[model samples]
Target chain A: MKHNFGAGPCILPKEVFQEASQAVIEFNNTGLSILEISHRSKEFEQVVIEAEALVRELLHVPENYSVLFLQGGASQQFAMVPMNLLPEGGKAAYLDTGVWASKAAKEASKLGNVEIVASSSDKNYTYIPQGFSVPSDAAYFHFTSNNTIYGTEIFEKPAVGIPTVVDMSSDILSRVINVADYDLIYAGAQKNMGPAGVTLVIVKNELFGKSGRTVPTIFDYQAHAKAGSMYNTPPVYSIYVSMLNLRWLKAKGGVEVIEQENIIKARTLYDEIDRNPFFKGTANVEDRSRMNITFVMDTPEQEAAFLNLAKERGLVGIKGHRSVGGFRASVYNALTISSINALVDTMREFEEKTK
Target chain B: MKHNFGAGPCILPKEVFQEASQAVIEFNNTGLSILEISHRSKEFEQVVIEAEALVRELLHVPENYSVLFLQGGASQQFAMVPMNLLPEGGKAAYLDTGVWASKAAKEASKLGNVEIVASSSDKNYTYIPQGFSVPSDAAYFHFTSNNTIYGTEIFEKPAVGIPTVVDMSSDILSRVINVADYDLIYAGAQKNMGPAGVTLVIVKNELFGKSGRTVPTIFDYQAHAKAGSMYNTPPVYSIYVSMLNLRWLKAKGGVEVIEQENIIKARTLYDEIDRNPFFKGTANVEDRSRMNITFVMDTPEQEAAFLNLAKERGLVGIKGHRSVGGFRASVYNALTISSINALVDTMREFEEKTK
Candidate 1:
């Protein structure tokens, strides 16, 4: 079994994959393939409801929030956030900590005014910006919880007094979260959830319809919430797979339990990097991500040699994002402790052989 | 096996279902589930490209058109059509044939002027409105070629001088279409293609950028077409299942052979409805859809009693749409001749019991 550490479409539980494969064959023994069953059927509706219920149970989502599994990814939300919240002639504040955060601001720029309150671009986004006060007059303060490309995570939700929104695409369910901390939380399902297709959106109901323009119904959260995300045919397979993955997460003692395991995985790799003179960690230790551990070797040749060694040991997708290249080990909830250990052994053996 | 008559996601070949199920467990034997592989990976990129190619080959699409597999269902396309095609202050004509067509018009009304050139709502949408003229000054003529609820279909494209737009959600691929007749064609994948979640949009590359507003990248046709529908993580499972189904379609001799089989299946059911004293088809005989065959019994009791019998005989999803309270047997391309024969036998047996 190869160790997969690709960023986004990272990893999932084997049992979930097995169950999903069975569903694709015959869901509830209905004799109809899951791919060909009606989305309006009772069998499929249960999947949607169960997925939403799991999200609520795992995260302790408050009653005021409406959880939606909508089409389009985080990129679509980049445009939808401004279209739904930034009223005509209104301004919004955003934090720029990575490529995705900057992309979100760019999409919002076409809708209304977006002011960058703080940015870590000067340091190549190696660390999360801190201690910047959000403008009280802005429509909402938006930020990304984790920088996937640069391996940085904001440990605490910014205490922005205004309505706060978060694009938690990469680190949503990796740890415990107080749903009330933000007015809206959005994430693409490719990371910890299931697959790429449906996006998860948790929005406080009161923060809608304030945008001055007539929002398209498909893009309107109120429309999706009212219809329970069935305004049309949803991506049924994506939702079903996600339900399986979440059910597995809950079975493994929920996010609280998973977070501890994640901390161990992160520490194991970071400690190895710190102990070995040949390796160096990329992000500031204080702002390092528990989900993605980014690191570099002393030289390009050494980095290439280490990658070849990792490959020989069945490690795959460990390559970092091309823009910030070296290596990234994405230890999502589904990535096992044993896989990380194997990767660690690969690195140690390479060091011993070279020395 | 039960006969499925639900409107979409309806029936698909068992072979396609099996292949899709296997893909979920282990795609291309890469030890990674199809749901876990990166979309940018060469393995998945081929799936996207091949699906587009099959769409073009089966539909005989013109060289000038671009095919896209996009997130969101046909309802999203309802709004996207206008957002992408209708210019500010520009009027477009429409044929409001049924609930879907009216909904499309409603969405278009939010974007620009949508003139309902003709409608059959006055008659409960029992027949297709014909001989209506498309305005030369209008942006384009929009119409739903098949009405799943009303069970009516336009046998021939309206001879319009302006550009044409078609929402072929429920009936595409059941029959052949002249690619040159329309400026754009959009369909939800649940019906004739694959599953819900991914919509198929085929557009003439030129009729873009005329919509006076800056369309959000997610809704912008030009943006999606340019990016090959990977502007973000697409519904990967949906697209992969679609490819498997399309490959099956091609192996069965493409649309020509499939359409012939579809006709035989429709004929078997429609013949029984017309010949039996206890039942009658509701659609105009000339305009009745070979895709969705709408019918009624001699009385409500007979309809209810027959539905019970059909259920007992393992028939699934034969209930009529609520608005039209008879029964609709949606026999899309994937439904088999033997399945329709079984439905016909059930109806005949019920008649014999009542008589």
Candidate 2:
């Protein structure tokens, strides 16, 4: 048996694959493949509408927030968020957690005065910086909910009275959050949501058209919101698959129930690492990401051995990011507790062999 | 039996769908779903690299021209092309054919000085406007290769002495063309390529960085081109489907073979539309798009009856744009000759009933 723990574009529910595969052949009894359907037609419009509604329902988003299904990953939102909200000299505070946070900060810097209020980069982002304060005059406070590369997460989101924007690309739908707390939240549908082509953007409608700079229509939140996310042809198949995944999430007790299962999976593996002397977990204990668990061996030789052995035993995508080399097991929402148990068993076996 | 005629997010080949379905279940004998693989891992990277290389090979693109797999569809490129290539305070010329052309023109107007050098809007864009002169000092002359909504195409791409950018969203890969003819060519993957979520951008490296405006990194063509389209988590699943489709295209006598099939399909339908007194062809003969065939009846009652009959007979998406008030049969690359024949038969039957 194989377990998939790749970070983004990671594991999805089996039912989603089965249903999406059938849809690819024939969609909605229309005798047309989902790939061939028109986005404007009533059949596909239902898809767009329901997908948006499900997003709102799943996240418990308020009526004031507009959920947009867009293209480009979270990287696009880094630029879009600032382009639509920041005036020429307006400042937006950013909390730099890791690679994605820095990329977002870089994009915003070109649009306006991007103030890096707090950054975990000083310590290579091994922990989420805490006690950061947002500027009262700032347009918005942007933060990455989960850092994939560094295996860190903001255990407690900062309270910024102004509009709060988050790049939840890696952790969306993995846990529940107060949708009302955030003015805008965007996530690339790769990790826990659905697929790679779609990005979900939930924004407070009242926060738009404030940017003095002429924003591109495609990048403007208002343009997408006004068109109901159909300003242009959206990522149809990806969005559909996301809808299926969201349906699965709903059926599987929604975010509230899934969060407990996720914690169990993450805790089991982390506990094994803590007890085993040969292996060490990365990230500050409180800031460690429940979704992606990164670990390293005491020696480089052991680390290489473990990775090769893991792959041979049908355990995959455990190699950590090159920037922070080690091993990473992404325990996303789809990752079953059995998979985590198997990994714990592998770790125990390797330790026994080494001893 | 259903015939899909939507301009984009349109039809795809059966074999491509079959292969994609299988891959979703088990990719490359890994026993893991394609969604489970890591993009950074060698396995997934091979897929991305090979897909880009295949596009370059199929188009015969020059070494200097970089191919970028981006998100946000070609509409994003409408703004990005100008934001990345238009010099500060610089002017650009555009040929407005239909809705998409006007949309791009509108976006460009917001960025810099836009010259509507030519427009078929005078004639409700029933035909492509020819004999337009582009300014030598202008950054570039932008035009839509095929107007999906209006059913017109500029078959012989205008040789504007300045840099030329074309939105090939509707007819890309339908025929072979000199990749060097334009400075930039972008197509949304849903039409003739694969599915929605991925946009293919082929651009000359030298023409970039001319726009003195600070382009948001996501909008910067250079950033994507330099990174070999891996600047961010790309539209992985969409691009993967595109690779499968392109591979199928290459196997079926490449673009040259598909072009012949496309020409035949368009000719058969247009002949029926022109010969029948009950219907009238919408586009001028010289500018008729081989990809999208538009027509209308003498009366709205007859038009509604024809559409209703067509839907009852398993014919779909043949209704025209509301702005145009007619019927449009989008004969994209994946549209079979049998489907067009079916549409022609439907038209003949409708003509017989009305006459």
- The per-residue C-alpha lDDT of model 2 at residue B3 equals 80
Off by over 4 Å in 1: none
Cα deviation at A48, candidate 1, in Å, is 1.4
In the range B131-228, model 1's lDDT, one tens digit per residue, is: 78877888888999999998999869998889999999988887889978999999998998988889999999998776777888888888888899
Lowest summed lDDT across 10 adjacent residues in model 1 chain B is found at B207-216
Clashing pairs in 1: none
Write one digit per residue (lDDT tens) for candidate 2, span B196-215.
88899999999778887887
TM-score of chain A of each: 0.99, 0.98
The TM-scores of all predictions, comma-separated, are 0.98, 0.97
Per-residue CA lDDT of model 1 for A1-355, tens digit only, reads 8788878786898898899888877888897778778888999999899999999999999999999999889998998899899998889999999989999998898888889999999988998888898889999999999998899998799998999999999999999999999999999999999898899999999987978678878889999999887888888888988999999999999999999999999899899989988888899899999988898887899989999999889997888888778899898999999999998899889989999
Score residue B315 of candidate 2 by CA lDDT.
83
Candidate with best DockQ: 1
Top of the candidates by TM-score: 1
